[model samples]
Target: MNAADAWKLACGNLSNSESWWEKVIQAYQEPCRHYHNVAFLDRKFKLLDELGTASDMNAVILAIIFQYYEYDPQDRASTNNLAHFQEFASTNDLPQGLRSKVEALLTGNEDDLEKNANGENDVQLLQDLDMSFLGLVSDAFLDIIKLERKEYDFMSDEAYNAMRRKALQTFLLIPNIFLTNVCRDRFEAQARANIEAEVQSLGK
Candidate 1:
């Protein structure tokens, strides 16, 4: 994966890096190289231009996770989305070393899930719940960004919807949120849809 993709993966796995790693190993057979891509640099500059070096890591993580729902790792992406997440996070004005930690987590989790699932040990279901919660946080920000872009002059609804779709997906992935002011004030409906769909999906 490229730098942008690495950052994206990192953000998607922001909390509970081990979970991200487990899924990543499931997606690809082997690990790839190190180094952030060029676009990552550009992303950082663009973010700094806007947020001026104090960009919210939570919001930024949400944004990257939003991108995660667009592509299916079941395809020929070579590796899982960890690379993509890292790419986006490193280049943008988000936190440093977060991507690295996530990568490490991904590497280590190669056997944890299977062992736990196979009854090798009891599972901390709450930790899994937190991963889902992160996705909900991702989705909440997606709709908010859509609404904000609409407020930005000359932005089209078409583009905004695309963004919203991605956010909704990330939100659906974890399907949980601790609670944020903007989440309740806005994006409540979309969040509900994500939760219901995820629940129904698991039921089936």
Candidate 2:
């Protein structure tokens, strides 16, 4: 499988984020870009303790976070998209409600995964959720932000801005997931503030 496929499926559980995806690639000539992207995220989980709410995550909420990761960040252009998107969905057999959303997203054959799709229904998922998990999630976010394709060498300002804008749109979705009370109170606000600041600083 390719680096993207390996990243989505291998990150079945939170711990899987730390797995060696480079070894699984067919073209294992250099650093598997996708693997390092994820590993960079895995390393970010260390901050959970600072929030004083590190050990709170139940398996599913944690699973939600993990499952959320597996879903492709790319949009669906056709039917086989489900087959492709499934590679990114959580391996744990998603919750019925969440599964319904996945099916809907797939069946509708939409372009990109939107904010409300996963953001709306957040209950005890956060009560059980912890700082470490958020740390990991944020790390994942950072890794994604740092993702630089070998293709995008130093180039024109317009070219760089276009890529940055697309990435910023994706990054904007994370705060929606953290809308739950604990996440909002502890991390979401700070994350948003930081994102905004960074977004403002991008070409300066």
Candidate 3:
């Protein structure tokens, strides 16, 4: 599904707001964005549909919608996006509990991952969906890397490769890249192979 269609699926009985929807669409359409655009959301929504295991699909979809709301290459922490999402949630009258859950998922810290391993199904599914790209076939994975690199075009090749290598290494260090059982079974080996290959190439 496209971002708009995914939003409708997520909203369900809730009234859809054209202005808010447009704001989200515009944010993803921003010139600097490449990998984190509407197409990324579409992939995530497809994964969510395939997984079909989130306890709170609404919260997962909401997190996907706003996770990179205003992505900035310099802002590795995504603090601005989180703040903007909080405001959006408040203004849209989202239930407090759902809002909090989406915030936690967006943060995606070690604590959140830990919680997901400890039975937080919704968080696990969302996190796994966000990371599903890492497990794509080599050509597809490299295609995403090319787009992601464009997002950081300001960085010199050496600097960007170093940063990319570190990020990929961090994932390799993790025992299991994908949290959910289904994701692990489907993606773990391929994800490791892809990351290892990219890390080696970055070194060259």
Candidate topping TM-score: 3
Instruction: Estimate, for each residue in 1-204, the C-alpha lDDT of model 2 and write its tens digit.
Output: 223433454344534344424332322233434433444334333232233342222322233233223222243132253443354345444455555455443344233323333342322332323232332345554554556433244456577766766665576775463644445655665566556655676753
Candidate number with greatest lDDT: 3
CA shift of 25, model 1, Å: 25
Model 3 Cα lDDT, one tens digit per residue, 52-152:
77777777788889877878887766547778878777677878777777888877643533333347566677778888999999999999999999999
The residue ranges of model 1 lying beyond 4 angstroms of the native Cα positions read 1-55, 58-70, 73-79, 85-178, 189-204
User: In model 2, where do residues sit more than 4 Å from their true spots?
Assistant: 1-36, 40-81, 84-144, 148-157, 163-177
Ordered list by lDDT, greatest first: 3, 2, 1
Which 10 consecutive positions of candidate 1 have the poorest summed lDDT?
Answer: 29-38
lDDT tens readout by residue for model 1, 1-204: 432443454445455554554543333322210111133233332432332221233333333333332233234355455566655455554465444433433333324332232232112221221222223455553453333443332445555455445664665565344233322333455456655554443342
**What are the C-alpha RMSDs, in order, of all predicted structures?**
14.8, 9.6, 2.8
State, as a TM-score between 0 and 1, how close model 3 is to the true structure: 0.88
Overall local distance difference test of candidate 2: 0.41
| Clash totals, every prediction | 31, 5, 0
